[model samples]
Target chain A: MKIALFGNPNTGKSSMFNLLTGLRQQVSNFPGVTIEKRIGTFKIGDQKHQLTDFPGTYSIYPHSLDEEIVSQVVTNPTHEDFPELAIVVVDSSNLERNMLLFTQLYDLKIPLVLVLNMWDIAEKNGIKIDISALEFLFPGTPIITMNARIGLGKERLFAAISTTNKAQELSPFYDGFFPSPIEDKDAQKQEIQDRYEKLRTILPSIQGKKSSVKSTFSRKLDAIIIHRFWGYFIFSAVLLIIFQFIFAFATLPMDWIEHLFITLSAWLSGALPDGVLNNLLTQGILPGIAGVLMFIPQIALLFFFIALLEESGYLSRVVFIMDRLMRPFGLNGKSIVPLMSSVACAIPGIMATRTISDWKERLITIIIAPLMSCSARIPVYTLLIALVIPKTYVFGFISLQGLVLFALYSLGLVAALLLALVLKKFIRSKNNGFLIMEMPEYKKPRWSNIMISITEKIKVFVWDAGKVILAISIILWVLAAYGPSDSMSSKIRAIKETSLYIKSTEPQKETMIASAKLEGSFIGITGKYIEPIISPLGYDWKIGISLISSFAAREVFVGSLSTIHAVHDENERHENLQTHLKEARRSDGTPVYSLATGASLMVFYVFAMQCMATLAVVKKETKSWRWPFIQLVIMGIMAYVGALITYLILT
Target chain B: MIQEIAVVLLLILSLAYLCYRLNRKFFSSGKGCDTCAFSEKGKIEHLN
Candidate 1:
């Protein structure tokens, strides 16, 4: 039998879903984490069933996009044809808001169940719910109290799900939006008051807490974290820690993944035999795909930290603190969440902008959100950082490489604010709506939710990005390896002959020298064509070609560079791209990667619209080729100017 | 095979574009900023 789970925002509805389905979605005690509808499947009693997990919403009233979906699903008359067995998950600690949805569902006369999730927290806070009283009040529906964090009382929930009626009617949920003044004003008021009084009566019996102390704990947590100055400091420290932790903690797993990918690529190369097909399948495709997947550990870890912050209710405080800071940028405080999310990827970051009610704020947030250095930037940043900053020692214990890495990230944020500020003045918008967010009660985040969230991130990063990257790399290999011209192969033959001649001069390094020279012959030519354009921005032909190819994804540049440099599919052969970068010389023997060039290229990528997928998404989101066109022009100019300045200053 | 795939992709893309154009010409002139908050422009007027 199919079951539908319903709950107010910030409720442990997701935890109950995870319990019932044995899966987790990143759960934050914070409001507004799950923006899109997430669906999963499970089997019960020899029957396969689908579980549709709607975005968390407070009420059935269509206020936000999430609420609209919830209202549509619950009130769909045709849902009667299917098993609309709704298990109303409630935060036992905060039942008043949950009751708003519960009362509406009850009126629909639908078969329902009450799950007092987070009962463990309720007990800790000295708040109690009489489950028996709840059962008596909502006679038809089963009332099951559960601590959704653990498996305690979960079987009861599933059993309740099994016995519930398939199709039950529900009443329309309402917030006290307006009061009727014409129809015997006194009588109408009396009627409304009576209904409220009736609800107020059973509500007290079901919930032991008085209305005076509701959200007191949350209020206390918010007081310190949302302080005008302290809150800002706390948020900065948290962001720094989270970011620094992603690099520090994920290093081991990242190394392991790197090793795994190299091994797999080697095995694939050998398994498929030495041919065009084999080279394409292994060297081109596998390594490119692996390049993306190798970063999955860091990506997952980043999400894990974000998930924890969200679940612990710290995220809302961030939104509250950032509101005043973001206002000057023509964005509201609500835009911070979306902007923060953009650091993960711009796709969800753009989607997260939907939470901002103000159209002006939303548009500005959406436009600048991509400027945040996403996980995609990690590969490029790592490459440049590897290629330029020597890890050995610079000034102090703090790795100079780390400082440069931090600056690159900070540059993305700086660019975002500047773009937002400019657009705030330039783009005429009508929306002036202010942010109104529910600050959820702070608690230790449930581990299951964090696990679920991190897993989903890993799954998507590997499955989605890996596939496309692999395909593009192989295509690039075809283009560079064969080219549309014969000069490519003949040029490589010429290089080979020269390398043999030089064998007597440098016998030990002949093999290495020959391979490097051949790379200059094939992909090098293509890079040279783009070299003139990129030279102004301080990029070499090699960096130019990688940047051009990485339009598909920035991460693929590492694989492209690795392949071009003739790095073997082995860990030992993977030279530090940074030292190689520093030592790299042109045919005329001048240094290839000067400080001016590296800084300029970095600045250019910061503002330039590089991701084709992002462009396609922007086209879809704005529902016009016009917005993307405007975006390309405006942001592209910003990129050019920014790169020009960086090159000038650094030189 | 890559050529075949590319050909099919181009065909499908153009076909979809044609359908989109036809739909826009016939259906409500394609929303014209259904959710836009800009009060200066007419509700039906499209943004460049």
Candidate 2:
């Protein structure tokens, strides 16, 4: 059986679909998270059913691309995804508003199982629905009340589905609600108003008296949260605390992971036989993986906070407040959701633009989306901040490093808005964008859902980034370990022949040979070739090499550095990448990761479109190489200029 | 000499694997990236 789940936005329709099919399609408190139709399967007894979770829409008439999918599938009998049975999941708490789509679907004469999801929320709000009365009004349709989040009514729902093979023969509610031609706009509007008028009369009888407790509390909270001045202040303060907490809480775990990896590498280096495979294992792969994994604590914490905001319904309020600020930049309040999602990743952030109806606004949002610093840049920022920024406190509590990290994130948002303002001028649109969304009642965060989200995000990060890091590490180790012809060995021999080499201790001699061999190797030659181009940004050839490798993903910059430094100081058992970088010196005896260099690199990462994955998503979303190509060039120039200015100012 | 040959072979295999994955990510599967959140769904429902 092909079952289609449809509902108004945020009615827990996707939640019911997930409960039925046992697939975790990303569900949040807000609407439009499921912007595409998702298909999953569930089996009851010997019969299997394919369930499609269509994007939420208020009516048959569509406003956005997401809503169009619902209209396209539900209205057309010959459509491939049209369903044999439609499950109309409505918010039991808001039946009058929710039943508009249900009645419209009824006028289509399709079989529907009216699923009253969030029944618990309705009951808490003191909404008593006389189920017998509702069933009488919409005779023969199975009305099942379910709390989908907690799986309260699964068996009854299954029983209802089992009995409902087809919609029973019954008179239409409106008797040809679409009597006028489909293209007649005025007729459609009148029909909708007529439907609402009819619903108001019938709903009062079915719905018992409702307590105003929850709504009163919610409205009072919103007054302060979405206030013109207090809202922005509170939002900024919330961000300040989140960044501070990430930096403060994650340091201990990050340090332990770094130490553990360094100890393991040293042990393996001594235990394994001295050979190429041993070098690759201890110096190449282990450190590369370590560099990526050490920042898991921070990444997990970042996702946890985002999940908390989303679950608590505060994210929608943030979007509301940001809408006012975004209007001047040729963006609507809707653009903020994608920009906020970009903090996690730009790919989904760009994909989230489907919810915006205006073409010009959506395009501008897509172009500026990459300017938001994503989680991939977290490791890069953390490393650079730890390298140069002091460990001092600002107000005896705020870590100076944390403040700098927060500033970097803020800088990305500022740059995105500025770019959108510029793009808004060139792009012309006939439609003006507006946001009309429901503010879901704030609820306590679900710990299990937060944990699941954190696990999924971390898995994507480690598994996806680990592959690239390990591969590049191996290739880099090869390039740094050996050189063309007899270049490395000859360089080592030449270094050994120097009087300074003979006069040095054993460790010092090994260090000299290591330096000589690295400079003579393949990666070294390539890095040196590009050194002049990047010199104005206070980067060495080694940093230049990392810059090149990090084009695969922004997070790869850390692994690239670890691999390079691991190869450079093979004889030295450094405690961590930070320690190795700290001790590194230039040929002129100045420190390599100086304040100017570290700040410049962080600025560069903040503006650079380093992730090819992001560019690929842009290409797919925009359906053209032109936009992604333009993004690459514009961001590349911005990164260079930004880095150059930072270097010059700091130096 | 055995270790040297082993290292060379391993490098070749890793490079090949990288190329294969990249091909799958970009050209073959048309999924954005294996790392992408929507990578499991090879294609999003098109607006067109």
Candidate 3:
């Protein structure tokens, strides 16, 4: 049987769905709308039923696309997801306001079980409910009081569902709820107002008096949280702390992961015989996998903080505050959520753009969303920052490295906004964007919800991003391992016969021959071909190769560099990537990763569209290749120009 | 010699598999990446 769970926003309906379904839930979009449809299954007495959790709405008469979905599905019997039974979840504390939608559903004659969710909060606010009175008023309908956060009232809800009849019979209270269909719009409004008047008259019998003190407290808190001036300050402070915590907490784990991979690589090299298999395992696969795994600590921490903000309801206030600022840039406040989400990763951030109603604004948000430095760029930023920026402190407290990292994040934000301003001028839209978000009341964040979010996000990063990195790494290994058949062998032979090779120690001789062979390899030739294009940015062919390989993922740059350098420099096999990069030099005897080169590379990563996953998601989200292709060209040009300017100024 | 030949064949098979997976992920209309939070149903739903 198909059951539908419907409710007003902030009624704890999703929480109840989570409790009922646990991990059996599947998320998809409703037909013709980007609004998410979450379905789950629960069995009662060996009979399994599908429950569809519809997006929250205020009434059957819809104002927004999200609400239109609910209106269409419930009113249209021919719809595929038309429910046999409807579960109308209501916020118990605000029953008068909540009953607006319930009355409509009741009049529609859909068989329903009323759920008085957040019952504990209602009771604490001094509101009393006469359960038997409610039962008497609405005959044949079961009312289940629940605190969905902790899985309370599950047994009773199940018992009610198991025994309830499936017939669509309206309660006696709703007999005259709908006045006869009116032709005029104003008449329809008058009828709705009359229904509310009748509901008010009936409210006294079933509901006891509630205090206004609790609501007043919420208002007073919002006064400061959503204040024009203090709101921005608090939001900035919260963001600063989140970034600081990520850097502080993730360092130990990141260091451990780095150390573990280095040791494993060394062990594999010692144990395996020298051959193609050994090189693939030790040089190509292990380092690539390690490169992906090393970023998990930071990624997990970022999602943890975001989940906390969302669960606490502060994320909505940020939307409220940012909406005003974003309007002049052609975006509404809803764009803030996706932009903030992009800080963790752009794929989900782009997916989150479904919440935005305007097409032009949403497309613009998707185009500029990736410019926000995601966690994928963290590896590149950390490596480059460590190389160029000294680890000294400013004002006796702030780390210089931390400040530079903050500047990179700020640059992405500023650039996204500026680009949005420019795109606003070109993309025409007649729809005026408005924010209709519900400010969910502040509460202690649920730890279980936070953990689920963190685990899911980290899993997505590792598996999705991991596959791309691994494939690219293997391809890179092949390109670097072999060269033109005879030329590579002859190059190695000639290097060994040189006076320098003959006079050198055993270790130096091996290093020279390895380096000589690499210079003749396929990747080496490809890198050289692109050297002229990248030379203006202070990059050699080696850096050029990394830049090309990293188009699969920005983080892959580090792995490719490590793989390429490890191919030749066996003595530095176990050395950390940072140390190896520091020691890398061009053929002209200049350090390859000088301050100019490091800064240029970091600038390029900040602006470049280097992630295939992000590009794929944009294509999927916009339902066209046009936007993603345009995004590629725009970001690529910006990266090149920015890198050129940075390198020129620094040198 | 046998070991070398086996390793060569294994490498070829691995590369082929990698290429196939890459094409499926980035090019074809399937859920390109399983780990992406966006549902495959959502991506393919609108296309049809």
Ranking by lDDT: 2, 3, 1
Instruction: Please give me the DockQ of candidate 1 compared with the native complex.
Output: 0.04
Each prediction's DockQ? 0.04, 0.39, 0.27
Better of 1 and 2 by lDDT: 2
RMSD of each: 8.0, 2.5, 4.1
Clashing residue pairs in candidate 3, if any?
Answer: A323-A333
Where does candidate 3 stray beyond 4 Å?
Answer: A24-34, A61-72, A96-98, A129-138, A171-221, A490-504, B1-48
In the range A1-651, model 1's lDDT, one tens digit per residue, is 556677876676766666666655545554555565555567768866666556666555554555556666666657532336777888777777567667766666557888888777677678877777777666768888898767789778768877776654433333343323333556545644555666676677667784424367777767788888888788766766665666566668877876786677667666754565655555455556656766777778778887888778787677677777777766776677778767778766776666665666777777887788887777666556555556653444445555676677788888888888788778767766566556656777878667867777666666555655655565555554554345645654565576455564544345444444445455666777888887777777767777776766567676666554433222224333344466667766677777677777777777777766566556655667787788778778888889988888987
Report the poorest 10 consecutive residues by lDDT, candidate 3 chain A.
Answer: A24-33
DockQ score of the complex predicted as candidate 3: 0.27
lDDT winner between 1 and 3, please give it: 3
How do the residues A483-580 of candidate 3 rate in per-residue lDDT, one tens digit apiece?
A: 99787888888888888889999888877887887877998778889999999999988889988878777888877887787776656457767777
TM-score of 3: 0.88
lDDT of 1 at A615: 60
After superposition, which runs of candidate 1 have C-alpha atoms over 4 Å from their true positions? A79-83, A166-202, A211-223, A242-290, A293-297, A358-360, A392-397, A434-455, A484-486, A489-525, A567-580, B1-48
For model 2, fnat equals 0.30
Deviation from native of the Cα of residue A176 in model 2, angstroms: 2.3
